[model samples]
Target: MNLTQQISEDMKTAMRAADTKRRDAIRLLQAAIKQREVDERIQLDDAAVVGVIEKMLKQRRDSIVQFEAAHRHDLADAEKYEVSVLQAYMPQALSDAEIEEAVSEAISIAGAKGQQDMGRVMAQLKSSLSGRADMGKVSSLVKTKLIG
Candidate 1:
């Protein structure tokens, strides 16, 4: 099933199981997806849905960091729960080694040389690695590869 369909089914399941936390998280995801559709006036495909999920996950991670930095462990833990819920829909994340391999391949494919080509390398990497690996780490690896 497509992500939207899967999420809908999961939402029903969550309701049937009386899973309040999962239900709320799934509802939040649905709201985000619906809001995007209304704003853009276009239905999102699975990839677009995945993009939305990734965006939500990033927001949760940022919130977690901010909460922890402010010494709010309770808030941080709450954000972590949200993150876990959102992560259920994501594909298995690529390992560091896998990410590095992909980065190397992207560099070669883009013919990236020196720091001047960082933008091009980054664009390729983003397209190639989106939803699979952390862009921040991928960027650092790209810089290291280009410089060293």
Candidate 2:
């Protein structure tokens, strides 16, 4: 089944299980996917769905960071819960070792010489690493490999 169909079934399961937090998160996700489709007038494949989920998770992570910095643990905890819910839909995350290997490969392929070539290296790695690894972490990895 497609991601949309799987999400529909998961929503129903969440509802039946009375998991309000998960159910609400899933609803918000579905709404975002629908909005993107309507805005672009295109059908989203699994990769697109993963992209949407990743965007939401990034937002939640930012929120959590800001809230914690502001000494608002309550709000940060809420964002963390949503983060966990969203992560369930994503593929297994890449390990640090795996991310490093990919970064090295991208740098070599792009013939990146130094930090100036970050854009080239990142462009090459984006699609291959998306949803599997965090770009912020990947960027640091690329920078480390390129600078030395």
For residues 17-117, could you state the per-residue lDDT of candidate 1 as single tens digits? 99998899999999999999999999999888989999999999999999999999999998888899889898788999899888888889889889899
**Stretch of 10 with least lDDT, candidate 2:** 139-148
Candidate lDDT (C-alpha), each: 0.91, 0.92
Clash counts for all predictions: 0, 0
Candidate 2 residue spans exceeding 4 A from truth? none
Look at candidate 1 and tell me the lDDT of residue 143: 95
**lDDT tens digits by residue: candidate 2, 92-118:** 888988988888888889988989999
For model 1, state the Cα shift of residue 91 in Å.
1.2
Query: Among all windows of ten consecutive residues in candidate 1, which has the lowest summed lDDT?
Result: 125-134
